[model samples]
Target: MSFVREDMNIVIVGHVDHGKSTIIGRLLADTNSLPEGKLEQVKERCRRNSKPFEYAFLLDALKDEQEQGITIDAARCFFKTDRRDYIIIDAPGHIEFLKNMVTGASRAEVALLVIDANEGIQENSRRHGYLLSMLGIKNVVVLINKMDLVDYSEEVFNKIVKEYTEFLNKIDVEPNQYIPVSGFFGENIVASSEKTPWYSGSSVLEVLDGFDKEKLPDDKPFRMPVQAVYKFTGDGDNRRIVAGTIETGRIKVGDEVVFYPSGKRNKINSIELFNAEIPESAGAGSAIGFTFDEQIYVKRGEVVTIAGQPKPKVGNRIKVNLFWLGRQSMVKGKEYLLKVGTAKVPVRIEEITKVIDASNLQNAVKESIDRHDVAECILIAQKPIAYDLAQDIAQTSRFVIVDNYEIAGGGIILKDLEDDSAWLRDKVILRNNKWENSNISREERAEKYGQKQALICITGQKDVGKKSIAKELERKLFNDGRIVYFLGISNVLYGVDADIKHTDNDSREEHLRRLSEVSNILVDSGAIPIVTAVELSKGDVEIIETAVDSDRIIKVWVGEEVTTDIEYDLHIPNYDSLEAAVSKVKTLLQDRGIIFKPF
Candidate 1:
């Protein structure tokens, strides 16, 4: 495929009723990029509805959207100037549809944040600005719309521009251009408006025409998320090809690559896109496939990368900053689906550090994150997966949190807490020793208890039957004359002065923050062994394992089957009878060299 140098994506975003769609429609109309019949059809529909002709109606084609005069979803419109061919993404301006805005902005190389010159900056104006920053879109061009409403006065335009500029600066978005344009009047779009003669700046088209696409960061590390795998049988070739869009950097033939989380490495044999085996390399934005020398285990959502670059971390627990979009408030202890790149995984809010009040951009001590609130939170996924920080690479770093089929929030990974294993171990050991020494003399405890064993706690969804099996194992161990503390992790949190149940998203952080405190007490008590049951993901398991030093901890898997690198000392399948599970626990204890005595 021949590479097109002039291809660029641009998203238009702002507060609702700020003429985003109108501006896009005007641009397309002025540039004569719209198909011949499209505009006439839109005009006839407007006439039938008895509604006055609106430039926005040209793009707002959805039934509900036409009734409400609001853009609920991201809409795409294609156009071309003499300088470049552009794919314009019209993002929704409402705070309720911020997720849609993010979805649109994620695909664009540059963004045009539209603001009403008459109304000045609204809530979503600031919000869209913040979101663009979070989405890693640094090249912004502010469009001051509704210049006609303000009498096309230069003073009004300058004042609004100055105020909006200061606000953007506060959020760290340096706009490349601020154009004064009236989308409805078609002024200053393709040509300069006669009304604003004092405004000597270039027209919107001129600015877009002059944009330097070469300045975009294309030299980042190669990251191609496997969207799908193709295998052809009818064409006589029996080879499998991994296919996806190149998110960043470049990949060429014979380049050594690694599939993430799976940790499988292979060499690329050829790069193919639509019947062609390209010679050079594929840059960002190209959708292509490559066949590897060896048949490695490649799955959808797994990241493919060059050999020497820093690998994305594969972990269950992650720390992130989230922008909440759901109508209902976000609460802790609730499970949500996380979609990062192409992989969707079960996730929960382990903690909420702080909730940001969107109206004032100030920290609020709320119990949960409500609609339109931004928050800094820690999420715990059910399994280990590959991810990178947004700052390091936005392609792999950004993720969406989905609740009940709706995208409730969007976030970016600020940092990965997986590397704190060493510190966690030290804290666990120190706390364990402190409890052991404070509770009883070493000699006395040793004489009373034959051996000291660490506790492993598990927690997750209800109906998993965690408590039933925990009691049975405790009974078997106690009958064997071995001291075992079979405590419900929730009971330890509530009954033993530790807080664990998080009702809302804000309090969820407190719940996770208390996990370490409770675990320390159990480990230090010097019980022969401690076993508590809770539903937890592999990522959380790794975190707790590292926190308490897994070498001394024995994690037993119950219920569903999962893949883990941790050496599980015991694996018990879900049983129909309690006695059967108890018997298995007894056998496991015997295997571990514990003597069973009947009372």
Candidate 2:
């Protein structure tokens, strides 16, 4: 049996009033893609409203859009060429609907950026070009519209092309070709027009057909994020299924599979799919599930890969290129929900290295990324997530940020950042793999103690009452019948670091590592271990953070002013008395759901 190839998603984007909708309407009408009476119905409405007929009216199907003469959202229209089918996405050109345009264009394989030659390159003209480049749409066809308005002048078309070409160059984007056309008049749209005698190139329809189809990444290593584990025991089914779409490569029955971040291994027992006979194998793009031979634990955020193949980078920190579309500014210290593939995690912007004004491609020294601003920054996830660099694995690297439960921004992973304690983390991973497990699990210990485990680090300048508050807080929890302990920083220096010298930075890090290792054990024993260290910077705390899950650490700084980059969970800006400080810390613990309510 023969199957039609996958449809190519093409998006048309530009500034408001640049005639993006008109071009799409014209393409659909010219190609005979529109259903019967659809065109006449739109024209009849225009006639009844005492308005001149326009091709754009066909796509501005919404009543508000027709009244306002503006598209407020992205609309998908279907068309076909003899070679293959096409899904033409009509993305709004207004700046207010920039996010809507991104939502459409982000998934497109090719882009047709329309610029009104009469208006020249507007604000969104440059902005959209920069966005297409950022969205990884490498194949672009620049169409300079409204040539008829300029009397089809070659000089006018050439001027717009030169200016727009320079702008695209600033963003490192090279267009496939520059076509001068008039969507309203249907000049050089489906066929060559005599009005443009100086121009000689393939029509828009021809160029579109010439574009190559997107090839599936079968050669890349298999990557399937475990979305869910299914067990239909009540339905009389004994199979435990791992289900998700294969993003790249293939997996077959009996193949050795590894789930990342937790690093569990198993073999694919059988390929399972509804309404089909049992298949032995499946390739990329197959939305299927499988049963594993072993009862290994794999979570939703983990990626499944062939055991011996290339594995995705696993970490909590990443350098990203993002476009902010939130009404409020994307600021540091604010927690945002980041979703990449099937993995969702709470993330914070660690640092904004640079911000670029998309309108002019100029760099700005801004403290916060405002709406419509593009930026490069480092993002720290609450926990480690498995992913790949956008260049290496496009399917797994793109992500979205949800603010206020709405998609506020989108980004691509430029590179994976190594945590400060990467070397020590390697050792921790190896240690956990070889560590013995008892019948009592970690969750059981947490529930038995009636409190969550945490490495509560209290640090500040000398004589700022850091240790006093930590000790009092520990005493409070202990009196409340909760598992708690307080240890001083100097308590382990003489014993744990007897062989290492004070001047060696590596030895100092090792000392911190040992302290964290001990904290990890105490946490496993279901104790809230509070450790007091003097002036512990973010980098210093990172050592302890890697050995234990950072989520299990409660950071509190006791000082009038913070001296380090560490964003502590709780801060005592005014340490007037020990009792007040202890009360505040205890209240914070209660708020974090780490400590149960006291009687």
Candidate 3:
């Protein structure tokens, strides 16, 4: 019979020595999928060593695993049934290697959770079940292995099914089927076993074929995280192409796409391809590139979705269900790198709402997350990022936390928390959509003024010489034949804050919003708006960034000591001399390419 070549990735997970590897080996042997002479070679080696040959040894490829008689890594194997091919990922069953198991399981569409009938339910059995749910593998089958050891008793099998079913229900995971099988004796795997006559269910191989293949998310909204921006000017081909693999839905030529976080929208001009006919359309799983109708700056790591569809959440803070695996605990206020889709941004654990014990389904209050601890927590990113909720779009919601260059944790975003700048972000999106573009682009104006438009924010303590430094910087730039303006907070209070009473926190936020809006106008005019504010926090700058491009805003903290938690681009310690402070700021501008440097 001709079998379809379509493949599905499936993972086998359970407690250590519960026959996960042996079941995979049996599947290989029964399906005649093993390489020629591989099984015989293993049997010969076992004979020479005076040890009985076992199917588990077929998968224990690592020396450490063989010595310890346990899996240390996720081993992969391929096999085929009469219907389709299967890529079996034999994840390590040891508790210590739970990280490796999670890594393996996250890539699978289906999971086979093995539980030794003789050993009953173990710690890893429940933990693996919980992890399978967290990883979003909805297709599950419980393999009650080592049935021969339990004398193939229906009562024992039912008990295990009952206990495991209860545990799975707590985590909201329902197994597709619970089957009694013995991999060593090869009973109830490829064929039914008479020993378990009361148990009526399909064999392991039969159930595998019955599983539905995970379909591509083509039906969902179009979402593609920009992986790269390609420009091939070498062969007289000056097309600037934005390229990435589509995570969901479809995009066609002439379709309008909006990039998230920036909220920049543009129309597709043409689909670009390498030595082939450019297709009119592309769907999920296609690695495609397209040239836009306008030369809007699209950066790598920005998620692009078709306009008029559901928009993704754009914020700096998110609530997530995370599982930690770092050697050091995930502590609050410590910075780590959050990588979601192609975007990698600095992040910090803001709060741990509850830590869960996967084995017993217990919850605890914790300040830090230890290894293998699953927690529902809030994370604050250094800047805004775009993502969907895990329940909405699983692909875009999943993220990993990197600490000290090592993967420490992974999670799915449950929801985005409205940050301080959320209101400003909404206003900015509406403003951008309504604003008419000038024929003279910002780049053209930058060339004309010999400097890029920027907001050089002079921030520090109440008594610090922020105003003095701002005026000096403006004078220096003016002398250098550049367009510059010094905007004081007092300048806006009389005009913009004329009606609004500065009594509550809402008025304070509105003041900053008005200042940012004015600065946005100055920036668009290709002029530097040097503004001074007392003790500006990170949240203040974030609000300003909503109106202006964050990269165009240069934050300079002028003080003897930093009192607020603001990340500054340049820290001018003790602005004792106006010229000295202004010189330092000019040097920073030159280094940042905001101003042309001396030839």
Candidate 4:
């Protein structure tokens, strides 16, 4: 099937009364891009109001904006040239609507920053330029509007260009092109203006057509923030699907996918769609669902990724460059909700490294971020969330801060700070050192139980029968008069690892650390602790080895295919026969002297 040309999203931003809306209105009227009767309806309304028709009236669609004679919201309009389609976002220019401007600019891949030639440059003009840079829009065209009012003076345009270029350069933004135009008179918009003999650049429409569309990042790693888990079994349908829109890369049936934060790995049983033929594969921009081979618990806010691909970072603390639009200054200690992808978590401003004045490129140290202030700060979320760095994958890196149920700020994550478990590790160290001893020595308990204390971990891929094997081994040891107990990872999740979450790298590490402590206590009581985990990595085993003596820990892998980088004491190809698998594990335990053979 033939697809339409990719539409380019471009934003027009500038100071109030700088002709942002006027330029868009004139572009629509001149290019015959407006809908039938739209321009006439606007002009007719102005005539009935006993006011002269102005090009700006074509936009300012909101009644409040028309009455106030300003654009208060980002007005989006669709237009097309012979080259491609364009969605022009007319961002508000008023200082009060700076937040609206940011919302519009953040969606755009290219920008047109307007400045009045007569007024030279205004505060919002400089601020908008800086914000466009922070939003990662590199294709920018600066328009020197109202040139007719300045008598098309080349000198006036040059002076504004020189000053603004220097300001933008400081913010690491080099404008793509600069053009002099008169939006009210419709000169240098659709066609070149005869009035400006000195200006040699292309007209606004030509410059717009020259801007390239943002490429779809299907080549990158797959990323889909789980929107919902649907278990619609009302009509006796037994399908449970995980649904979300793919933000990048592609996925196919039978591909092993891993859910971030949770690290649950399962194979895609089938691609699910509504009233459509099942697709073998889907790429970026497809809103689809999938049924997994194994029934694993997956929740919304977890990022779905293909196995063996680069994983997203998971941490509670993040370094970001954000613009604050809250009425009150964003201060430290105040709680806010940070929304990234489908995840919303409570967050606080941990530190403000620098508060930037976008208008003049001035930097200052401040404890709070004032209204319309852009700052580099560290934010600490209540729970870890999965995200990519803006430099790597911009689609999943941007986030919004909601204050009092209002979107008060937006920004892109720069880096994931150190995991939240640094202090926890220290606490664990102190705990091990200061741990109390029982009246009966560990040697006495081992002699009484007639078995050596050991921690045996059964781990492999999902649905690999590690749990079944571990349980069977537990029963065999008990029947053989050995002191042994089976421990599932979920058992400690509610009691010991209850304070932290189950997902994310740091929380997962902390969870394993606590599990290690529990295993240590069980072993100290001279009982064999058999733990079953899913996809235990080398690092996970090391965490357990820290608490329990490495010599007393045994790792076993049970699967047809090995997916983790863990060296195991024994590898059972599959659990085709449960008793056979259990026998192999018991033999390994007996050979290792964890359990004594019949005397």
Candidate 5:
């Protein structure tokens, strides 16, 4: 049988001065992947700096890095062995450059962790190893680099291997291979060394070549986050094609797909790769476009998945395990934008359950996650998003939190609690109860108003004439001698709750928390509140209703029905007619015993 080695991406990760760059340089040099004159430039630069030309100089291409003898960013290089072609991503080893490390590792299939044979496992060495595991890079090769410094002794290598292996095993990172090599002296890289007779093992290149690439898991549920929509017009016919890369799993022609959080469904008519209309199937790592049978609703950042597979939950609240990288400590109630794949959303840290100390992997009693700390917490987004558990699907599960333009933290979703209605309602109610009684008693407030039977919540998509309806309804209710609290969701989300900013999706959890808290205050104060949100999922509506302790919540479905249930689902025939929607809300309120006329 003829076998062809597929393309593989490998990243080299370790602490600074642990020879990550040297190992990559040596690999490129030994494999003859270096272009002619590249090494001469590095040598000439090193000479100008009045420093010896080290192998690491080859990858420190930046002028500042070459001057300081430190790597500030990740460098990518391509090399091929007789067995396979590989793209080596040399990730930064400094703790300050962890974001860069995550950037590089996000695109890699395997990681090579280089640890100093003499220094053993340092802070960043272990830190990068833990992050690699968290990022779902299962294939690892632990290179005990710089064996020459320890006299190439088998006893030293064995001891270091035993200690590091035990540590990694505790963190659930059992490397595929552990090799002793000296990247500086070219020992056990391409050829085995005779210095350590008892260390009988294949060279790094041999181990890499012998690695079972087929063992990597490629069988996941079909998930392709739509990146862009292509329209080839003016040719002959108008064509609209949705294009994106398959993050995981396989999609075949005629397979049913659902676009979310829109919940639009369509069938795959054809799969289109570059210059090819492949008939059969498309798998992970395939960047292709698809022509659907019908022009269903699809947009960028929406996850396209195989029907009947576990659908992504659309909600405001999510449980995540995060690693904070900002210089300032991550505090609760602060807003940020959460970026997952191509989706950028406003999010917030609702609560910090515990911070995991990376030094010992123990839960520490910390108020907030400081720089370079990992923590497990609950994150909530402002709008509903499609996501899976990190354990179930790695692609859609992981996300990055961006504050003001820079990435501050990265995390993986541990659970999706959209279906847990009881839990969701309880959280809202508890938070409301805490915020209550600060001003006045609910009964006293109810007595202050005359004849409003119950608090009603009017919710729908933003700019879907929600504010207009609210104003009209308030006018009708006022004419009927009833006090109406026209509390706009946007007003509360922006004005009274000014602490919560709608800058980006990173502060989503904080936004929801504040929004729900304010809405609860309004409802509990015995006023009819009209709230509007562009994308309120069924889960969010349920939570809001339960929080205010009222079944009077009415949902007007302006667009596609993303939610499951609504007391009054009004899909307007002509949204242009504001008078019709106002008339409907008045009748619905009257039917629920909310008398319009005091007489």
Candidate 6:
């Protein structure tokens, strides 16, 4: 006879030598979860080696490579009571394997934070507590272990509890209870021990059974990041499937679906499963596939949402709370891969807002994040990714950073900052979503024109002779058999914006937006548009670049007064002579293959 039993993943996390493995070993032994002869086999090996047998040695024997009692990888032990089955994930305690710790701990719904009763709270004890809150696992049970060594003293347990409770409260984590237990002796673990007569609380086994079952919150809005767009044409399979695990909400057949970052829209034709009855609808946590009513260009990393539901924020820059575990410090300007959900993009630390040393939870005066440092920073990526703030949606908000093919850091986005080009990007995405393709492709246009389109924006201080240099460069490029058009600043102000009032700073921004919009169309028509704006900020350049292709835009500052935040590709200090300045600008273009490389 079979009975239904739910599953709960619980992680045992804390400092090294805190008896995490021993607790797991004892739990398995006392519960009769282990197969017969398993415990005796481990004892026999220990006797042959002339070593005192330990319950932790039962787990150690199963460890194929790592010698330390601390679990290097996320090791799972299965046990079942009359109620439910538990997956006790043994997570590493050392800082060296923090990435592995996060890997195990993040997946757990509830956590067991074990601390040595004798040694007291260590650095990793606090650090792991901080990270557990960040990982969104709030149901924690503080297991004060090794009471046998501490002589089962209530004073010792209470002192550690008082200290650790204060720290946890500081980090916004209130553990369920502080339980005293001896993993080695099995005191107060499976049963209430007389050694602690002053204590009256549930046993470790009781607490384990009492934790709630993890469930998919289907009431929330639907979100499914495209894991893979499958097309199995071989072996007589013609149906293309969109495969993924729904992170939230539910989806049904015939429901309109939208894929974001691309903004493609379609309807679900059918839910697909192999050798199982087809599901009419799938809810959050369901790993299934569906065929679309229409073939949209869906691919991996695009988030799927119900067409009428709330949309995820799309941006390239965001502020995050991250912990760096890399051997090398997480320095600015170095490229790292940011992986959130299935989406991966090249990222860099745009700014270090604050760095907090996790060991002491104190602000550290640092320029770059070191190993095991928790930091609040801003990250700028090459392209926009769809996500929600961690406060709004927990699952979609977390990400990890990879350096040199290793996971060096992990973070949760606290908030989405205003990307300079957010408004323009939204317009661009909507425009692209509804854009009608011409019979002639962009490739055909480039092939026919013998040149790809580009934008060359010349900017600097107010008194800088931007127009003279821009016109001269355009004339020179035009004379050199290159297609170029120089659009004057006055023309943009008057021709593009003859109606809008010249009121306040917003008008200037609107003027630039219109200028970029018009110039972008011309660039797409196989023409290099030379635009000159005085004292244009880097933010201004970013706004224009959002309207066009970033790779196709060239920024040049013509004067020494670099007032704006722009990182210009080329700078000419002396703007006295138009011809010389124009020649210098042309040299940059030639070097960049914008015009022509020197033969």
Best by lDDT: 3
Model 4 C-alpha lDDT per residue in residues 370-484, reported as the tens digit of each score: 9878999999986667899999988899999999998999899999899544355445445643555565645457678888889999988888888888898889889988888
lDDT of 6 by residue, 1-599 (tens): 99767888999898988998888888888888887898899888878989888888877776743265456787888777878888888888878888888988878998999999999999999999999999999799999999989899999999999999889888899999899999998988888888889899989999888877877779888999999978766888657799999999999999988777767677899998767899899998888898976555456887998988888988999999999999999999898999988999889988999999887899976789999899999999867889988988888999999999999989799988887667777886786567554555454565676566789899987767888888888888888878889988778777878887866667776788889888978887778899988888766776776567667888898877788878788888885678888888788777776655667
lDDT of 2 by residue, 1-599 (tens): 99857579899999888888888888888888988888899889878989999998877763237777788778888888787788988788878788888889987989999999888889899889988988889889999999888899999999998898888888889999999999999999988899999998988988999998878778899999988988666766656788999999988899988776656677899998888988999999888998977554356777888988998888889999999999999999999999988989889999999999899978888789999999999999876788999899888988899999988999889999987556776776566545555556555677788888777999888888888788888888889998988877677777766677867866878988888888888887789899988788876777786677677888989889788878788888886688889988888888888888656
Clashes of each: 12, 0, 0, 2, 21, 0
lDDT: the better of candidates 3 and 6 = 3
Candidates sorted by TM-score, best first: 3, 6, 2, 4, 5, 1
After superposition, candidate 6 runs with Cα above 4 Å error: 1-3, 65-70, 234-237, 432-599
RMSD of each: 13.3, 6.0, 3.6, 15.5, 14.3, 7.0
TM-score of the candidate numbered 1?
0.69
Candidate 6 weakest ten by summed lDDT: 435-444
Q: How far is candidate 5 from the true structure (C-alpha RMSD, Å)?
A: 14.3
Off by over 4 Å in 2: 62-64, 420-599
Query: Residue 44's C-alpha lDDT in candidate 2?
Result: 91
- TM-scores for all candidates? 0.69, 0.75, 0.87, 0.71, 0.70, 0.75
Could you tell me the lDDT of residue 471 within candidate 2? 85
- Candidate 4 whole-model C-alpha lDDT, 0 to 1: 0.85
Candidate 5 Cα errors over 4 Å, as ranges: 1-5, 44-50, 61-64, 214-218, 277-280, 419-599
* Local accuracy of candidate 1 as per-residue lDDT tens digits, 160-201: 888877877776789999989999999889998897888889
How does each model score on lDDT?
0.74, 0.85, 0.87, 0.85, 0.74, 0.85
Candidate 3 per-residue C-alpha lDDT over 1-599 given as tens digits, one digit per residue, 9 for 90 to 100: 99548889999998888998889889988899988987898899889999999988877642236777777888778999878899988888877777778778888998999999999999888888888898899999999999999899999999999988988888899899999999998888998889889988999989989988899999999999999998755767756799899999989999998888878888899887768889999888888888987666667889999999998999999999998889899998789999999999999988889999778978999889988789999999988899999999998999989999987889899998988777777787777656666767666798888888889998999777899889988999999998999998888988888888766666877899999999989998999999999888987887887778888899999888999999899998875589988999999999999999998
Please give the TM-score that candidate 4 achieves against the real structure.
0.71
